[model samples]
Target chain A: NAGVIQTPRHKVTGKGQEATLWCEPISGHSAVFWYRQTIVQGLEFLTYFRNQAPIDDSGMPKERFSAQMPNQSHSTLKIQSTQPQDSAVYLCASSLDSGTEVFFGKGTRLTVV
Target chain B: AQSVTQPDARVTVSEGASLQLRCKYSYSATPYLFWYVQYPRQGLQLLLKYYSGDPVVQGVNSFEAEFSKSNSSFHLQKASVHWSDSAVYFCALLNTGNYKYVFGAGTRLKVIA
Candidate 1:
């Protein structure tokens, strides 16, 4: 299996610039998740999608962060006006169902300067 | 508020030595716990998981994790380590029936040959 695929393994952007991260989950997986990995904050859940529906996005920053899964195959996390504090590895994961063993993709390392 | 903590930020062991990575979770109800490994420049891969029935679950690469409800701990152990085993190990959790998973800061294991 190809597993999960994420585009632009590494990204660099200036402060105030908009950034978009993309994730293509494994085939047949119904659940997709987004997480931010950082040294201080650790790994934090940003949002999740199940069966192409937004289940819980409480982890997302209400103002700047947004995620969408128009189709089951792919999901996108968009951050408007990226900040230096937003620099982190944007990880995407997938599972057959909720609360199951999720597989992760090679995260998009976002570096905001 | 459910969460997972991996106290050790890093661990080092010689090849062929026994290894153990500790994980503790705080959850109101019994939740699903998992261990995942991420190699350098790679995505996270499932090592094993525990839902309910058994206290111990075996995962790929001869990795095993024991769930202790009384202590609220799920520690991952292996009888012997290999040079290839060097990677960052993460402990994750999910609510009783929720698919939203939360992950630990991660424990980086360095196996020396």
Candidate 2:
């Protein structure tokens, strides 16, 4: 199994630039999640999708952060005007269903200068 | 508000030594617990999980965890660790109905060969 595939293992962007991270979940998975990992916050939940629909996104920043699951196979997290505070490991994970264990992607390390 | 706490930011041990990592969660009602490990430049992998029965649950790589509902704690332990066991370990909890997994900050382990 390929597990979960994330594109662009590392991403670098300048201030005010937009950054988009992509995640391809395991086949047959019905749930996808987005999380941000930092030294301070540790690991924080950003958003989650179930059956390709946005389930909960309370953890997402009110502005400049959005996520979408246009198709069942792939999901994307976009951060507009990426700032230094936004620099962290953006991790994407998927689970077989809403009530099953989740598998995580290698994650995209974003560095905002 | 739901939250998880991993008191130890880092734990060091020698190879072939027993290991124990502490974890505590704050949530109401029955909670599903989980332990995951992440190696360098890799995604987090499920080590083990606990729901009900069997306070002690075994996971892959000879890892195990004990759930203490009264104490609201779920700690991960390994009988013996190898150099390959050096990684970051995270503890998580899920709600009974919705599978909202909340993760702790994570404990980084360093094993000396």
What is the per-candidate TM-score for chain B? Answer: 0.96, 0.95
Task: Give all candidate RMSDs, comma-separated.
Answer: 1.3, 1.2
State the lDDT of candidate 1 residue by residue for B1-113, as single tens digits.
Answer: 88899999999999999999999999999888989899988888889989889899999989999999999999999999999999999998988556678789999999997
Lowest lDDT block of 10, candidate 2 chain A: A36-45
Worst 10-residue lDDT window for candidate 1 chain A reads: A95-104
Model 2 agreement with the true structure over A1-113: per-residue lDDT tens digits: 99999988999999999999999999999999999988898888899999999989989998999999999999999999999999999999999988778899999999999
DockQ of candidates 1 onward, in order? 0.83, 0.82
The model with the greatest TM-score is 2
Model 1: colliding residue pairs? A99-B99
- Cα-based lDDT at residue A4, candidate 2: 96
